[model samples]
Target chain A: MSVDLDLIHRYRRSTLTRDELVKVELELQRSPAWRSALNDTVDAHRLGATWAAVEGSLDAPTPSRLERAATRLGAPQHLTRIMGATPNLRRAWMVSAVVLLLFGLAVSNGERETATIALFLSIAPLVPVFGVGLVYGPGADPAHEMATVTPMGGLRLVVLRTLMALLTSLVVVGIAAVLVEERSILIAAWLLPAVALSAATLAVSSFVPIRNAAAGVAAGWLTLVVIWARIADDGVAAFRLPGQLVAAVALAVSVAVIAARRDAFSRAVSTT
Target chain B: MRTEADDRALLARVSRGDRAAFDELYRAHAGWLTARLERRCGDPDLVDLAVQDTFVAVWKSAKKFRSQGDVGAWLWGIAIRRLIDQMRKRRPTPVEANVLFDQVASAEDELFVGGLHGELGESLRSLDPDLARVLVATAVDGLTTREAGQLLGIPQGTVKTRLLRARREARDELARLEGDSR
Candidate 1:
């Protein structure tokens, strides 16, 4: 149980043989008395400095469970980190999406009224459109300027964050569609316009702030729905074949614009 | 009594994301780990960051603790490597060891550098601090020569030459000390 002074000297001075070195290493781990003995030798100020360092770091928070799950499920660390940091993936965003879906379902309930159904479907697509817009715009990221200098900051960040928001919104919408039973068909009709508008929002974002682009796309979409209904005398007319074709065309054109101007995705339109 | 088995059990809980166990493990080793790291690094701020980095890595990958040995050794293994990484990042200008020692010398290192190791310590006390550091890392800490190079922020070849010179000089110093005693 007695401490070996010469052995400790040789160990610290690196004068010990390899076998002797390994023995002391094991001895330190296995022997509490040795550790205590070593501790006893350290002056209080030096040990206090060590304790201060440890205590300071104890407050650095661990990763959240969702982030750990993302890593466990095989998302690369960089992608998971980006997704976790994205402002649009906040719990508030998901809660708002859920609220929108619930409100949509409640308003159109049992009435099967064409006007109410059109209102619900039209608003459904805007949920993801708003989310995609928030992925990489000025005012969307507090670190937007700092982020631009990072390798992952611009278009790559936008695309990854957009997929996250869009998929989460789809899940919320999908759940609502199943709950409405017969109205599920009307809910399904929201798919084409949802993608088209989300794409159009990002495409337009290449030239303007995301907030301005999202606001314009949402306003334009609602105005188009009102005009089409007035001309056709039916609010539900936009979910018809010609309307779906328009959504399809919009999707195709927005994608082409996005590809051609992809560099614009990395910086805020105003800054760029 | 806290035994090796207790460390393993704590590590088992740590692997399952138990925060309490993690905190317990950190408390058990952080002081000692910090003390040891300070010997190799002159900057306390960098040492603090290295300690934090070590535990953070352990938090993420406690499940990878497959060695049947003491958790203490394993923790030191991770910590020393992390210290090297932190040092590389900051690359603080090297100050003379004696100056660093005088400025920050805690009572314990006073014991280590002057009082504790006796005559063998006297021999190494004469060796160049840089060469002495390579010996401590590779020999006492069980790091490979390449790892000692990384830990000391020197080229591997430099570490090799320094290590050889250190061992030869330490031997000569011991012989001189013995001759003086006679």
Candidate 2:
């Protein structure tokens, strides 16, 4: 007998008449395949429906409750220490401070030429690259296994560390830009490259080792800068409109890649 | 049918610590899980605990959820495993077979086994309890074989073998009843 998918659908929805229901039941009794199909349809429909009886028990732990649980269980201390001892943020700050100090000395000594400022800005985005690369990866994180087993594993962890690195680098570099004596356009030129290169590094790191990905990104970016400098007759020409446009497109593509491969970050791969 | 894309999107949001998405997922499947588990164990508290743990596990493992699979089947698999865990922990007093039979027969009397009286029910009652449990979980409860295995704390291959045996025995019993009637 040919099974009517529409009949099974209507029967599951309880839209069948008494006679229709009997007919369906007879068909179920006659054909095991039909019975199986009906069972699947019913199960699928019921599985999606809300059970009012258990609704009261489904509340997730709230922030206050989570805090209380953590305190009672002595879990907060470990998490607090981990957050406090983040080596990435510490190294990021140190690198940023040193870079800013060198730029400050150079500016104060009457050496704030366009080429020098552009060169410094080009290299500034690498601070976050190194910072994020240091924090991520199995080798970098002593608590990598523990963190991966937690609910906040995978993309969430990647986003958090990357955001911290990006923000730290941006703040330090933004301050350094303010100190530069160049035009505002030159001062803002580093922003796009910083975002694009950092995002691209993260996207690449999802598949490759974080350290290798960071190195490749840095090398490719610096090579582009040097080549542009030689070809454009101006050493600072890589920070121009065409470069900024390329950075914007690269940033968009990198973000897409990161989203598509977000789960890869959760895998236990060692960084070289 | 809820689209796979919709469930995948919800799971993606859930992985990101989205409370609203988690709540939506809970609302969607909690009741069905509770009902199926309640039927198995006959203890509301045990069923509730299992349902809660299932959602919690789902929240923690949302990142591992495969987008290509059926979300309901996946959620059902988790719920059954949680139910089994709860069963192992407390071992709720087993309802006697006759009493459980009466309860199920009365509840689903007209809906599932209509017109046949107790033929299907009796066939179910006569099978080995383990095989019967697997059969009910899959055929009656509407869970897939994989899900039934997860719920029963057995391997998928075992679920398949037991299910095939259970179906053969049930069909034989029904045929015998038909022969006797004729």
Report the C-alpha lDDT of model 2 over B1-182, residue by residue, as the tens digit: 44456777888999998988987776555654554455456566676777777887887789988878767667767876787678768865453421112233322333533333344455554565667667666755467787666556568899999978887998898899899999
List each candidate's DockQ score.
0.07, 0.03
Q: Candidate 2: where is the Cα deviation over 4 Å? A: A1-85, A100-112, A268-272, B1-182
Model 1 — TM-score against the truth? 0.55
Per-prediction fnat values?
0.09, 0.00
Which pairs, if any, clash in model 2? Answer: A51-B31
Per residue, candidate 2 scores C-alpha lDDT tens digits across A1-272 of: 66777867765444543334445544543453454455454344343333332343445333444345545777565443334435434665556556654665475556548666766767776767776766666666777777767776777766776776788678877776776666666777888888899899989988898878888998999898988888987767878889889999999999999999887877723335
Worst 10 residues of 1 chain B by lDDT: B98-107
Cα lDDT tens digits, model 1, A77-114, are 77887677755435666788888878877877777567
Error of 2 at A91 (Å): 3.8
